[model samples]
Target: MAEKIYAGVKVQVDQEGYLIDTNQWTKEIAKEIAKEEGFELTETHFAIIKFIREKVAKGEALTLRSIGKSGATDIKGFYQLFPGAPLKKATKCAGVPKPSSCI
Candidate 1:
């Protein structure tokens, strides 16, 4: 049988950033993202991820073409701030709600 991975079960790094084993993410990632966004981890961040998750559930692609300004390029700037963040993963963690096509 294949190993099972949760929808949001990826690891989160400190300010240095972390790798995304799978497309999914984790709450720790969310908290790290909040710190990068200049905000403390809170319910709002969770809400944002839920909203993104809902969009993904609705068949929307997580691509820049679909999400607008949040295109892959957007993460380049964020990467600079965070240093080693997996751009797309970090975006997802940050509650940016990536379109299905972003990756």
Candidate 2:
């Protein structure tokens, strides 16, 4: 874990830049992270981010198929939204830890 400032708030993040303490997450922090990753978050993006965060809080496995099933968006749409590595980007923007399924 490493300390960093996001949205003017100090928080802990992992080596991959995912938030280590989910409690420190805020919409402003999500915006900062997404912007840093070259993504401009939209309402659709926020929906996906919230969905991923909820699933993670429940200890559910994070995966493309799982996100697709979330009804926030289909798998194909997810790919379109996040491009190359949708899951990785989504998790980061959601202020969740990097999914073990990633990397």
Clashes per prediction?
Answer: 12, 0
Alpha carbon lDDT of residue 101, candidate 1? 50
Best-fitting candidate, measured by lDDT? Answer: 2
Residue range 1-103, candidate 2, lDDT tens digits = 7898988999989888989889899999999988888888888899999999999999988888888888889998998888788999999999888788842
Candidate number achieving the greatest TM-score relative to the actual structure: 2
**Model 1: per-residue Cα lDDT over 4-88, one tens digit each:** 2224553434333433332445677566555655655445435444545556666665543333253323434434433453335
Candidate 1, backbone clash total: 12
| Candidate 2 error regions (>4 Å) | none
**What are the runs in model 1 whose C-alpha is more than 4 Å off?**
1-23, 61-91, 94-103
Error of 1 at 101 (Å): 9.8
Residue 3, candidate 1: Cα error in Å is 21
